[model samples]
Target chain A: MIGVELRLMLRRRRVWLCWVLLCAIPALVAVLLAVTNLAPAPGQGGAFLSAVTSDGQLFPAAALALVLPVFLPITVALVSGDAVAGEASTGMLRYLLVRPVGRLRLLTAKLVSVGAFVLLAVVFVTITSYIVGVLLFGFGADAAVGGAGGITSLSGVVLTPLQLAGRTAATVGYLALCMLAIGAIGLFFSTLTDSPLAAALGVLAFVVVSAILLPLDAAAGIRFYLPTTHWLAWIDLFRDPILWRAVREGVFVQLGYIVVAFGAAWANFATKDVTS
Target chain B: MAGQRFSRRWLLVAAGAAAIVGVSAVQLPAAALDVDAEALRRCIRAEVPPYVGYAEASGRLGLPEIPQLESVTTLLTTTTRIRSYVAGADRWRADQLTGALGDSERDTYHLGAAEYVWDFGGNQLTRVLGQAPLRLPRAGDLLPPDLARRMLGLAPGDPVTAIPARRIAGRDAAGIRLVPTDPDTTVGRVDIWADPTTALPLRVEIAARTGPTLLVSELLEVTDGPPDPAVLRPVVPPGAGAVTASAADLSGALRDLRAPPAPARLAGRARLTLPSTPGSDLPGVGVYGTGLAGFVLIPTGRDVADRAVDGATAAGGTAIPVPFGRAARIGTPLLSVAVRSTGRRGSLLIGTVAADVLQQALLELPARGRPS
Candidate 1:
């Protein structure tokens, strides 16, 4: 069942298009940076994208940072939002239920497939960005020299290539897990409505609202509970002697959202009559 | 029908989010107003002594200190090699000390606008009227007296708080912390120690945002009486030729000595005031965010662009080639200089900001000032 669901997600042209869009963005950024040789001013674009001119090895990490806030989350929403809702809307839910498949088992398979798609999407962008960045700007030492020759790490020690690669991998893995909470939210919305469009919009609305309020000092207290608050916490992985406090909090927050949202989805789908 | 159910949940989420924001709004302003910069400034100002008695001091200005008997100049920091040794308010002397090998010294005397400079280094002495000469802070002023005055004179937006009292210069003093309100400022904070009796600053330290004490000036010892009157007089050796500089020549030479136009906003946080006119012997005064952070751009009259490039080459610092010209970091801490010149006239953009910020400001100024 998981294999069939995974194959279904892969065969979709829109899913493939999302991958293409993700890969093309980093290449475009690299080309633009190479041609212009001017970095974006502070607080512009991805946090570390400007660092690419000085060191290309930060490219993959920067690419993920650029897209994670919006593009990557939206892609996850599209697939996960359609998981159960698209089936119900098209009258396929009733047939699947008639084949002795428990609704619980069906949801589990669908979630596993969606999760697989999320992982694949992230890995594709990372590999493509690394290759394109290395070609445009030669990979140098992992020593993060800021501006002229200032050391930026908290410990003031540069990381080796293997250590940098390991940190980057850890960042990618953490970001993938972070998206699962959004996927769960989409899946919950998918169960609440039969229209896949409505489900996707629901997830997008939650994300957009969270982002809008993130900067406001008034929202600071309760910000820790919001999923958006933790999206960028993955940057801590690159820190020397990596800061685990925020990263750990982010994981627990996302895990809590996944549990509550997936539980709600299961509760609703188990009893809903598949009239479509 | 299903849309209606989801709409109800959406409204609930929105309300919860709004409630969180509402609660945060009520609490944050109270937290932010915790420090009052104005009160802190007044307290420090009240403590500065009106007079700093006979004092002797020695400290490192950056890494190198050229030790001298009567007075020591840390190579004067800038390329011009301008040095000043002042005893008190009415009597002070500044010398345009040049030559790499103790080659020459042009000593200038400042006495109530009657200016006399004996250029023994260039073999000429010049007299000028109505030209207010630039005055470097005298060693007497470098004590608790002048540094406290500058701290008190800072623009008002910086938050100032009173910390614990501590002993400085053998005197018990209260400490005041000044934090730049502008997020973009390179000054992390400034700590000033003021005499409990005189309310004058006894010690001042300027630190960068990245946590390093960049500049510190303190009096090692101070007496209760004035110095010998002879110490205040300027003595010129014989054989120096005398010349006269016209009023017009003085004005023209100092024309580019005006202050940099005020930036609308610095580092996007501090709003700036209109720049004041150039001071006699002083360059331009540019203040940001009510004086939390500011810099004086003193015209060097030399090609600052070339100087920056040369300095960078020697200092092992990278020279960022900009459209206007080149910018470079010449030294570290107390002696650090950011050179920005258009070759015609160059001004050293010196302040408490990090090296890169100085470079950015110099690079962006020319483009920002003129309209296409």
Candidate 2:
């Protein structure tokens, strides 16, 4: 069933569109910066993006930062929001329920498909940006900017290319899990309603509201538990020593979100009446 | 007989107790001396930094702030003279007295958010109405106790011992010295001379690991009289050309010849912190390292850096290879400056720190032409 769902997701033009959009941003930025004379302000952006104006090898990292804040999550939310709600709205869920496939198994397969889309979207962004950035900015020696691990680590050293690659993969994986947690929330909301658009908007609204509250000093104490709080923790991967405390905490928080969200989705679908 | 034997043992015990008491009595004065030393340390700690002295001077000398001094001071090892005059907090004037036959002195001034340069021989005073005024370095900052504490990287509980008193310019002063606690730090030691009465630092000497004093600032003369108010104002000669530096101006005229614009962790090892300065100097001075091993990156326009480098090379300075570009080691062991150019701008990496540390800074600092 998971394989079938994955095949269906891969066959969708919407999923491919999201990937194309994600990949285009980095390439566009790379080309624009190459032709233009725009320079990033002093001490702006992460170590990698800051390096983009100097070396093109960092363009992919810069592009990832640009998309991570909004685009990637939006793509994840759209895919997950449509999972159960889209089928139910089209009157297909009632027919699928008649088959031998259990409601819980169906929910799992939908989640896996959404999770696969999240992975594909992120990988597309990273790989596309890397190729475009290198083509435009010419690969140079690994220039470590600040501190041991560069931007995030307490150590003031730059990581080797192999180490950087490993950290980047880990960061991308963590980002994927974070997106999966968001997708699970969207799936849970999808079970609540038959409108796919409404489910997607519900997930986006939570993210937007959390982002708004995160900046208020008064909400600082409780803000740590918000789903959006650790969205940028992947930046620590760029640090030379790879600061683990925040990144580790981020992973745990995402896992907690996934557990609650997936559990709610399972309970809802199990008991939900499929009359549509 | 039993009673007599017991009485004798008691007597021996009383004798031992009395001996112990007598020894403690002899050590009482030593304990008192320790108390005095602690008091001295506390007083020195409170009075040494200019922050405290500034307050004391404000109360004692019926003045708004210390009068800005514009006087020519000769470098310790070289024939070059630097004329520095600071006014109205941020307004500054610095003139390099180049002893050339036909070349007049070059002066850089920052007046009311405007930075400009005056070439006496050329009869031109070019002003930068650029995005911001370039921050210039000051001589007074080198002698502050706060900077000394940071340079030495001292913890509150760090051991700071007293050096013998010295008579500096006729003022009797005691010196407090801090040695680097971290073995990895390149700094050897820092000595701050404080007036015993006022607790203000009279002189400061920073030394390297090899025991050569890297920099020293001492009062050559003393005067409590208020400075003439007339000299406090900068006088620009008539008919000098005025030039405005635009925001995008990357010309040698208005490069951000200041330190790093923001706090940066350099070469992924140490954080470069901006040293706190009074209103007189602009707030862009960057000092890297909390330990002995650190360098100061003074941003100068490419012209200034090139001139200095050329001047040093002409005087038989050695060229040192760096990752970005070649740097020059001007002067001997007594005084030297390593000049490196980056981002089309030039930075002078000045310190007694090891050459490798300077090289690391040169390799990692952002290129000078804007962010790109």
Candidate 3:
């Protein structure tokens, strides 16, 4: 059932378009940097952007930072928000339920499909941006002279290509977990309404509210549980000794969201009426 | 079937509610610890065991920004979050987490006598060489343990009393209060809480005489054990920009400047010779008095003194008439700074004393090119 759901999601042109657009942004950014021969000053613009000019190998991290704040979460919300509500709006949910598919199984399949979309989106962006970064800037001139072909960690420690790849993989996994939490919220909202756009907007509104409160000193009391609070914790993975405090907190928070949101989604969808 | 589904849904909601309650229950205050104030103070002064923790220091002194001293002013006024690892006095690391989004961080690694500063934003590694006789404050100075120890050291003769023990960072921390009797000091009292067992300070709060608490540093979470040795040693990455800088570089006002000798006594307080690596004394610098009631006299370039006087005056500093060129005094609840500009050079008098005390000290300062 999960495979069928994944295949069906892959068949959607909207999913492909989202991936292409996500990949295209980093490519355009790389081209502009290459042409202008300028990068944002350190401590400005995106996180790893300033370093990317010297070392193209670091561009994947720069690209992740570029899209993580808004673009990536939007696509995840769109896709996950449409998971169940799109079927109902198309008048397909009732028919699917009539074919002896249990509500639990159907919800599980939808969640897995959403999860796959998030992982694919992140992976595609990383891979495509790496290619674009290397094609435009090449494997840093310093790597040739120093004979240390690796990227510099945020703590000024040299991380070999192998270490860089490992850290990048870790970053992908961490980001996927974060996105899945958002997807779970989207699913919960999808179960609430039959209109796909309404569900999508609901998820977006939830995220927008969290993002707004995440930085306010007044909201510090409740900031810990905010969905967007730990989204940037993945950046800690690049620190030399790998400061695990935030990352550890982030994992717990993300897991809490996944469990609660998924549970809430299950609770609502299980007893939900299928009038559409 | 419908009833069973409804019960399961309620069960899920109940579970979520229980989880939140469980988390909050862990944070409930622990029982007060019974310990003597003097013992706790002694233990705090003694060598602490190796440990790791996350600390946050916040201040509301509302210090005005001075040219070339913006970073020092920011450290004294805003909230600073730090991840600190201490293996010994000389081996430790403090990573000052910066940026609202936690996107950038600066790490100071003190391995033995050497210090390396790593800036995550610029990806630059700097090796700080030599100890400056006088330097501006940095974020590391605000860590709970460091700040608590320094405060304790500065007020040895102050009366120490036991305050009620409180739970901090999930540990029952025995508390001590130091009340300064020196009238020259603006500090009203200082409160510190430390782990009853290890004596590692978990929180420190400093309050001025006439206002609310001006500074507070607390360890939000801590673990008592040696941190990984690798974390203390900074490895400069190849291709990353690396530079060596002297500690004097931190205080741009004190580099390559000379001044007239300071008076033996300022405002009726005897001048104190600052402890430094013998030959590294910056000559005209003088520290007057001792304990929590004293001020430092630093020679400054004329331009810097003029700019500082302008900045302080603009920030509500009062102009005080002096025999020299000009003088201005800015007083916060906990700190007072007086800038005196003589003919070709100037000197700054700053301390935790009152505005009048700084004014008197500025008056006693010798003029440029004159033997006191």
lDDT of 3 at B223: 92
Mind giving the per-residue lDDT tens digits that candidate 1 earns over B238-311? 22245777433454323453444434444333434433333433334333333544543444444434654575
Q: What DockQ do you compute for every candidate structure? A: 0.01, 0.00, 0.44
The TM-score that candidate 2 achieves is: 0.45
| lDDT (10s digit) by residue, model 3, range A79-124 | 9999999999999998888887788899899999999999999999
Model 3 complex DockQ against the native:
0.44
TM-score of 3: 0.86
Off by over 4 Å in 3: A140-149, B1-11, B99-105, B120-124, B166-171, B209-214, B220-229, B253-271, B275-289, B294-332, B335-351, B354-372
Sorted on TM-score, best first, the list reads 3, 1, 2
Screening candidate 3 with a backbone cut-off below 3 angstroms (N, C-alpha, C), the clashing residue pairs are none
List candidate 2 segments past 4 Å from native: A45-47, A143-156, B1-372
Model 2 chain A poorest ten-residue lDDT run? A147-156
How would you encode candidate 2's per-residue C-alpha lDDT over B147-254 as one tens digit per residue? Answer: 443443344454677777776545676777777665545556667766666555556676655646656655433332333344334334322344555433423222
lDDT to native, each model: 0.61, 0.58, 0.83
